[model samples]
Target: MKYLNLALLILFPVAWFAPLLRAALLPIFGMDEISVITGLQSLWGSDPAFALLVTFLAIFAPFAKTLGLALIHFGLLSPKTLPALHILGKLAMAEVFLIALYLIIAKGAGYVTIETGWGLYLFTVCIIVSLFISHKTETS
Candidate 1:
């Protein structure tokens, strides 16, 4: 279990940097793909506040949670930190992912083609594994 947690700690950032989504425009004229960072940057041009919120939730929050967990796992941080970290983790909404999926489905309803990228799967795995690790740590 310790090893699993450590492995997931390493994987979370890799998943974050990976391409999370891909879209193929009509007639194959253009193909676009984005990672979380790129997605946030793109959104910034349109809605800065939404983009900032997503960035905080999707990027900063996870990074901080993982770091906090790692500290706890390694006996560096006090267990007292766990409660606060847990709350933060709970608020680390994956709404950005849902919005991306909604856009894909809505667009593909008629004209566009969207592909689920490995990054999305990887990031999701990170989230689930992290949750499990957190629960296990908290309980034990």
Candidate 2:
């Protein structure tokens, strides 16, 4: 379990950096892919406050949760810290994933062409794995 958590912890960042969505404005023109970093940057230009909130929830929260889990797993942190970390992890809901899915479906429902990319799937995997580990640790 420790090794699995460690592997996921390392992979999370890689997944975060990958492109999460791709959309084409016109069939003749080309598709533009957006990663989490790029999406946040774009959001910042349009809405700073929203972007900041997303950064805290989608990026910092998960990173912190993973780090906290690792520390607890290795006995670097007391088990007493587990509940706090668990709450933090819960607060780190996968808003980005839901947003991306919404955009894809909503746009596709119209005339736009949008598709989910590997990054979104990878990000989803990270969320699920992290949640699973947290639940397992809590039970054990």
Candidate 3:
């Protein structure tokens, strides 16, 4: 777990930056664009319900994890921060994976034609690495 956490910590920074880096290079290099991974693009063209969905997910998701982390850090919960971080990271990854799955399925079904944006791949990698790190560091 500790090793995983360390790996996550190292990868997390990379993931965070990968999307931006890809975005910068894609247009210049003339790469085909695709669905969004972690930015406002996901919100674009979404229905009104999407706004509510985003709000609910955004608030509740981070709140739970951040609260748990706070509890542990402030002595309200366990002394370690790994569990909270891991669980939060898991939640984050689940959401990203689901979105990616949805996009892939949509494209396969002809509902949408994705263009393979570099940001999506980078974001996916980021979430996966974060999950691994969180799980590695998590403790009972």
Candidate 4:
């Protein structure tokens, strides 16, 4: 379980790198508007079907990640930090959800895109693996 927890922590940074790298490199590399976050939006905003898919993902991604975080740290942290971690768990999902909601409702398309970059996919996988690790750790 400890090994798994360590593995999950390791996974987080690796998963984050793909989108991070693209977002950092795209403009410098002469790739116009190829942001991992906005690229997805630009790619699918025109189509209602794809847009809905992106919207759903954007809404749920944070929830999934934070929930994993919550489980990962729950009861494992020292008592003094437990409350803080709990609050963090609840709050961590907010950013992406708000951004996605704003894009879908206010922007009404054309301002951003949703592409589900490699980082996003990897992060999702990492969250799932983390959850599994959390469960296994808690039982033992």
Candidate 5:
């Protein structure tokens, strides 16, 4: 579990740049790949508020939770912090929900075509893995 949490230090960053969605406003045009980084870039320019929320949920939350777990694993931090870290994991999960909601809305609205990309699954798996590690860590 310690090693798995540590692995997230590397995996999460890769997931960030991985393409989360491929969206095309029109079927005739090439779809643009939107990764966490690209989506943040877009949001930062047009909506700094949402950009901050996403940056926190998609990046900060998981990173913090992973780091917290790492510290606990190494005995550098107390396990009492686990509950707060769990909250962070839930926040990370929220980002996935946001993406799914966006996809649903875009698809239903009909002018836009949105496809789930590999990155979405990668990001989700990382979050779930982190949660599992945290749970196991707490149990044992």
Candidate 6:
């Protein structure tokens, strides 16, 4: 469980910078790769409130939960905090749903092209692995 949590700590950042989507607003322009970091960057310019929400879910929740769990594993934190960490993991998972929902809406518009990137899978895997690690930590 400790090792898995550690792996998530490293992989989460990689997932953030990796391309989660390739999107082209118009065919004249080449598709641009969008990672979590890039998406958040643009989002902040247009909608700071929504960007704050996404940043919490996409960046803070999972990473904090993982770090908190690591602290517990290393005897630096109370295991009593595990339940709160579990909630954080669940919140992080919601970001994936939001991404998918946006993709569906954008594709439905019939004017944009959207393609899933490997980073989507990687991000999702990191979320799930963190959730599993949380569960295992709680159980053990």
Tens digits of per-residue lDDT, candidate 4, 1-140, equal 54555565566546544562222222334423233345456647667786565544443443444444445555544434434433443343343444346435633444433333556556656555644544454455
| lDDT, candidate 4, at 42 | 69
- TM-score-superior candidate, 1 or 3: 1
The C-alpha stretches of model 1 lying farther than 4 A from their native spots are 96-108
Clashing pairs for model 3 are 1-136, 33-115, 34-115
- The lDDT per prediction is 0.76, 0.80, 0.48, 0.47, 0.93, 0.93
Q: Pick out the ten consecutive residues of candidate 6 with the lowest summed lDDT.
A: 1-10
lDDT of 4: 0.47
Instruction: For residues 42-118, write the lDDT of model 5, one tens digit per residue.
Output: 99999999899999999999999999999999999999999999999999999989988988888997789888899
Backbone clash count for every predicted candidate, in the order shown: 0, 0, 3, 8, 0, 0
Q: What lDDT does candidate 3 reach at residue 128?
A: 62
Could you tell me every candidate's TM-score relative to the true structure?
Answer: 0.85, 0.89, 0.48, 0.43, 0.96, 0.96
Tens digit of per-residue lDDT, candidate 2, span 13-68: 88778988787776468788888888889989999998998888778888788888
The better candidate by TM-score, 3 or 6, is 6
Give lDDT tens digits, candidate 1, residues 1-140.
66777787678778777887677667377768777778888889999998888888887776687788888888899988988888767766464466466666757577777666788888877777777888888999
Ranked by TM-score, the better of candidates 2 and 6 is 6
lDDT of 3 by residue, 86-121 (tens): 666566656565556656665575333345445556
Query: By summed lDDT, which 10 consecutive residues of candidate 4 come out lowest?
Result: 20-29
lDDT of 1: 0.76
Error of 4 at 114 (Å): 3.7
- TM-score for candidate 2, please give it: 0.89
Quote the positional error of residue 11 for candidate 5 in Å.
0.7
